[model samples]
Target chain A: GPKVLQIPSHQIIDMGQMVTLNCDPVSNHLYFYWYKQILGQQMEFLVNFYNGKVMEKSKLFKDQFSVERPDGSYFTLKIQPTALEDSAVYFCASSLGDKNTLYFGAGTRLSVL
Target chain B: GQQVKQSSPSLTVQEGGISILNCDYENDMFDYFAWYKKYPDNSPTLLISVRSNVDKREDGRLTVFLNKSGKHFSLHITASQPEDTAVYLCAAGARNNNAPRFGAGTKLSVKP
Candidate 1:
């Protein structure tokens, strides 16, 4: 099975600070996605990127959040001036196509104190 | 306003029995539905999926039944094993959108 790798399995940052989560998707996957999940809650969709552009985003994807996968390198999600509510486990996923099955990484837990 | 909803928070089943998980959705435009399984400290993995074009899909011990009229779907795991214990999430996606909505997930415990 193909695997997606997420860096920094755990991170603790002060509120109002910038934090970036990295993901290495499958080599041939074209569609990338980011999801957030708080403890004991459902996983919420954040955003999806494809072909160097954002294909779609949920309301939870605040203006402070941004995603990029420049030059086919590690896909990154950056949150600037993080808020207390931004603390959650962020999971990165990718698929060969929009309708294909998504492969997910273990996840990066970000705690904004 | 949850577009996809899983009412059951948790369920326990005896090993070798059937495990059924249910989900309902409010979106009519959703044409694709999938089930994902997750263990603690792990990300959700795709278990099974079905398109609106089909009412049911089966692979090995897993089966997904979709009722478009009712806007509902379910995952059935037959001959459940203890290792099958995990959180199951149901997700739905519309053809025109890239983001898929997910349910809260049902934590299943297969008792041996």
Candidate 2:
């Protein structure tokens, strides 16, 4: 089974600091997605990227958040100024296409103090 | 508004017993439903899925039942084990299938 790998399994940062989360999706996957899960809450969709452009984003994707896939490299999520509420486990997933099943990474646990 | 709702925040079952988790969707346009299992400190893993066109799908000890008429689905785990204890989430894809809406998740505990 294919797997998505997330870098820095755990990160602790001070509030107002910048943080970057990295994800390496399955080699052949075409659609990539980011999801956030707050403590004891459901997983919330953040954004989806394909063809080097954002396909869709949810309201939770705040203005400080940005995503990029530079030169076929890893997909990254950057928060300019992290907030306390931003502390959560961020998961990266990829699928062959809209109709294919998604594969998830182990997730990056971001803790903002 | 919540598009998907899972019943029972937590449940406990004895080993070798059956564990049933239920989920409901308010969006009639959602045609795809999936179940995922998540262990502490780990990302979710896809367990099973069902489309609106199907009534039931089974894989070994795991079974997924879909009731399109009621806009609901359920997952049954037979012969539960301690390893099966985890948070289970149910998600549904809208007609377009671009994003999936997830339920809050149900925590299952299988006692020895």
Candidate 3:
């Protein structure tokens, strides 16, 4: 089974600070996605990226959030000036293409204080 | 509104019994449906999936039945074992877009 590895399984940061969550998707995968899950809640879609561009994003994807996969490297989600409400487990996923099975990472738990 | 929904919050079944988990979606454009199993403190893993082209798909003791007309789908596990206890999450997605919307998940407890 292909694996999407997320770095720093747990991250604690102060509010108003910038934080970057990295994901190493399957080597052959082309589509990338990010999901947010708050405790005791459903997994919420944040954004999806393909061909180095963002394809679709949900309302949960705030203006302070951004995503990029630099030169075929690790895909990253950067939050500039984070807020307390941003505390949640962020899961990264990748798939071969649309209509394909998606591989997900273990999720990076972000705790904002 | 939740595009995908799992009405059941939890279920319990005896070993060797059949476990049926149901899910529903509100989107008509969704062409792909899948079921994911998640253990405690672990990431969700793909168990089985089916596209709208078919009504039913079977893999060993696991079966996925899709009812597109009703906007619903289900995952049925036969000869259920205690090891099968976990949280089941249903998801739906479209063809051109890869971001799948997941349900709230239903927790299953297979008692021996």
Candidate 4:
């Protein structure tokens, strides 16, 4: 079992503000992903990244959202000018390959007012 | 800590029949096990879970069977309904690994 740590288990921000969620994936994992889930809803896939580039992304991955893992450091998801609709739990996951099992963070709950 | 396998990609069963979903693991340290259910366009949600300490667990019409020796587990849904149709995912975790590994997924269709 590899731990995927998500910073600040809970985050509260005002609408139109900016926020950055950080994740420390498994050291040997190469494929990375982000999922969004609202309470009582299903876990929705946002985007997947590999080899320092985005492999695929869903429409839910709005233009305001961006992901990057710089120089082999923490993988990050940043949202600028956040909207109220963006409020949900964001989970970060990583695996050794795209087809491998994903190790997920406990999730960062974003509350935008 | 890594491999969680769901051999079946899809299943079709009659309404009110029993629906079985199976999963396997490659790690011996896997002490935690769980299942997730997902609908189209929705995120997967935790359904039922059990630890290695127990061999079976039941909730309403859902049951989880674990066989440590075989390194396998399964979810059995009785009285299956159309509403039960969704993608099912299996997850396994080891004592030393905090991250639980998940299987690809198995889509289930209950014909009414």
Candidate 5:
């Protein structure tokens, strides 16, 4: 099975600081996605990127949050001036296309204190 | 409001029995439905999926039954094993939609 690897499995950052989480998606995957889960709650959609652009984003994707995959490298999620509410496990996923099944990473748990 | 809902927070089933997980949705426009399984400290993995055009689909021991009129779908795992214990999450995707909405998830415990 193809795997999506997330770097820095756990991170603790101070509130108002900037934090970036990295995700290495499958080699041939075209569509990338980010999801957030807090505690034992449902996984909430954050944003999806394709062709180096944001295809769609949910309300949970605040203005402070941004995503980019520079030169087909790691897909990175940067939270500028992180907030306490932003503390959650962020999972990165990728698929051949929007209609295809996704391959997910273990997730990067971010804790903003 | 939650577009997709899984009412049961958890369920217990005996091994070799059937494990049925239910899900309900509020959207009629959704054409694709899927089920994902996840273990603790791991990401959810796709278990099975079905499009609106089909009412039921089966693969091995897993079966997905879709009821459009009821806006509900279910996953039935027959001959369930202890290894089948995991959290099950349901998701619905609309046509041309970029992302799918997910349910709160139901944790299943298969007792040996």
Candidate 6:
């Protein structure tokens, strides 16, 4: 079965530090997305990417956040000068197309203290 | 606006019993609805999906029923097992090319 893989199952960082989360989407997938789930809260969409550009982004996607699919190798989300409220489970998902079902990675847990 | 709401924050069922989870959405333009299961410390995995053109979709012990007019959907798990215990999230996509809006999720526990 096709699968999405995320690196660093867990990460802890200081409030002012920077962190980059990486995702390896399914080879044939054309659309990639990022979602965040705060403890005990619903999963919320962060952004969507396709054709090497951002398709849509939610208000939750802050200025400190950036996403890129450089060289078609890995899709990554980088947060600079992270804040305590940034702590959450970040999920990476991929789909064959915009409307197809998304397959998700195990998730990267980020904790900022 | 896109919003998906799930009912029954939590549920417990006997090993051989059935479990039902329901969801509702406010977006009338949504054309795709899906259910996902998530285990602790893991991302959600797609369980099943239904398009507005169809009312029911089933796979193995899991089934999804959609009511387009009411903007509601339900997932039914038959003969539940302990392994079926997990958080279930319902999501709806506005169009074929849009991102999905997910519900808070339902936590189900199948006891032995």
Residue B29's C-alpha lDDT in candidate 6?
92
Candidate 1 wrongly placed segments (more than 4 Å): none
The lDDT of each candidate is 0.94, 0.90, 0.95, 0.85, 0.94, 0.92
Stretches of model 5 off by over 4 angstroms after superposition: none
Clashing pairs in 3: none
**Candidate 6 residue lDDT tens string, A1-113:** 79899999899999999999999999999999999989988889999999999988889999999999999999999999799999999999999988787999988999999
- DockQ order, best first, reads 5, 1, 3, 6, 2, 4
| DockQ winner | 5
Docking class of 1: medium
Q: Write the per-residue lDDT of candidate 2 for residues B2-105, one digit (tens) a residue.
A: 78998789999999999999999998888889999988777777899877888999999999999998999999999999999999999888665467778999
Which run of 10 residues does model 1 chain B get worst, by summed lDDT? Answer: B93-102
Candidate 1 residue A83 C-alpha distance from true site, Å: 0.8
Better of 1 and 6 by TM-score: 1
In terms of docking quality, model 3 is medium
Model 6, B40-65: lDDT tens digits are 87778889988889999999998999
TM-score of each: 0.97, 0.91, 0.98, 0.57, 0.97, 0.92
- Model 6 Cα displacement at A79 (Å)? 1.6
Best by lDDT: 3
How many residue pairs clash (N, CA or C atoms closer than 3 angstroms) in each of the candidate models, in the order given? 0, 0, 0, 5, 0, 0
lDDT of 2 by residue, A5-78 (tens): 99999999999999999999999888899999897777888998988988888999999999999988899999
DockQ for each model: 0.79, 0.66, 0.78, 0.06, 0.79, 0.74
Off by over 4 Å in 6: none
Model 4 CA deviation exceeding 4 Å by range: B1-112
**Sequence-dependent TM-score of model 4:** 0.57
